[model samples]
Target: MSERKPRKDAARNRAAVLAAADELFARRTSPEDEVTMADIAAAAGVGKGTLFRAFGDRTGLIHALYEARVEPIRNAVEEGPPPLGPATPPLQRLPALLDAILCFKLDNRHLALALEGTGSDSPYQAGHYDRWHALLQAVLEQIPGLTDSDFTAHVLLAATRADLVEHLVGQRRLPPEGLRAQLASFTTKVLGSPALPGSPAEQIHS
Candidate 1:
């Protein structure tokens, strides 16, 4: 008989391994107490060798998890709602993008925490920061009469980051809707633009 192909079960096993690793990493309170290859393999009902074959090692697994979770957000910023168009005013586009980005952070808090946990020294951290900075710069380039547009863009990006939002919402127990509104107002003020009329709170809650 011809050699039988690996069954669908093998594919399931690989997915389970990655999922388990991601969960463990996200929940880990400290790097020292983080999950091991054996822990992930056992959780996924696979052998250590199988896990290794799939992801090489723990660092590889972490990298995979980071990419899997972050790529979607990056794609959304690039192509999703509030479509980028030359006709769209920067004042209009800026608030919409800010809302979209804050919504993403609210939804993906755990994944963001995991990515940020890698520290500023990590390659992944640097790449993420650079990507965000570029996105902010693109948005700012459309605005008029800014003396230090680039610096202002960087500040805006930092204010909207997941970690800062989580600190505001999760720790401070501020309503996400209210927080977004406050942020949108503050952002417009900092950029020397008039606040968008009507409370973003109503739109957020609705």
Candidate 2:
């Protein structure tokens, strides 16, 4: 019972830490680089020691927060229904998948920036990137006449990169819906088809 109590406390602490970090990143006006583990600990009302023990470092904390935020999208893509699920047609699903990713980056602008900016490791080498690439490549493979699924996947995913999203939204001041329309058109060209009908991007505003 004592051991179970510590485990429960640990889970609770982890949840509190993630929640605090999410709030901090969402609210920050400065670069995410300035948000430290110490800041998260203070905001969570936990000691710095506890925060460090739970997440190891700032990068890990950011990664965890990103994963938590993306969990719903992940589930929808993996198992939920059409336009995102495994059961959808590749032609339609491809645009939906990319649209979902773009929307995620747009919504969590700061958090996405933090994850891509963290550490020295190449963003392309990250586990999340690999999973997205693999899934995209697999979908592309299903479409007829689409060769080089690997390179195509990279290209499509590149369009949704956090920095690019920031540039278009922040620097260019392009509205989110406008960006989505552009992406849909770009994706349509890549797929060698007319603009995809019933795109999941519509659900964003609905």
Tell me the spans in candidate 1 whose CA falls farther than 4 Å from its real position: 1-14, 21-39, 48-53, 56-63, 70-72, 81-87, 120-124, 197-206
Write candidate 2's Cα lDDT for 1-206 as tens digits.
87999999999999999999999888866453478888899999999999888888888888899999999999999998887899988888899999999999999988888888774656785668889999999999999998999999999999999889988897789999899888888999988987655656874334
Minimum summed lDDT over a 10-residue window in model 2 is located at: 197-206
Q: For model 2, how many clashes?
A: 0
Q: What's the residue-level lDDT of 84 in candidate 2?
A: 88
* Shift in Å, residue 129, candidate 2: 0.7
lDDT of 2 at 78: 90
Residue 59 lDDT in candidate 1:
59
How far is each candidate from the true structure, as Cα RMSD in Å? 4.1, 1.6
Go through the candidates in order and give the clash count of each. 0, 0
Worst ten in a row by lDDT for model 1: 80-89
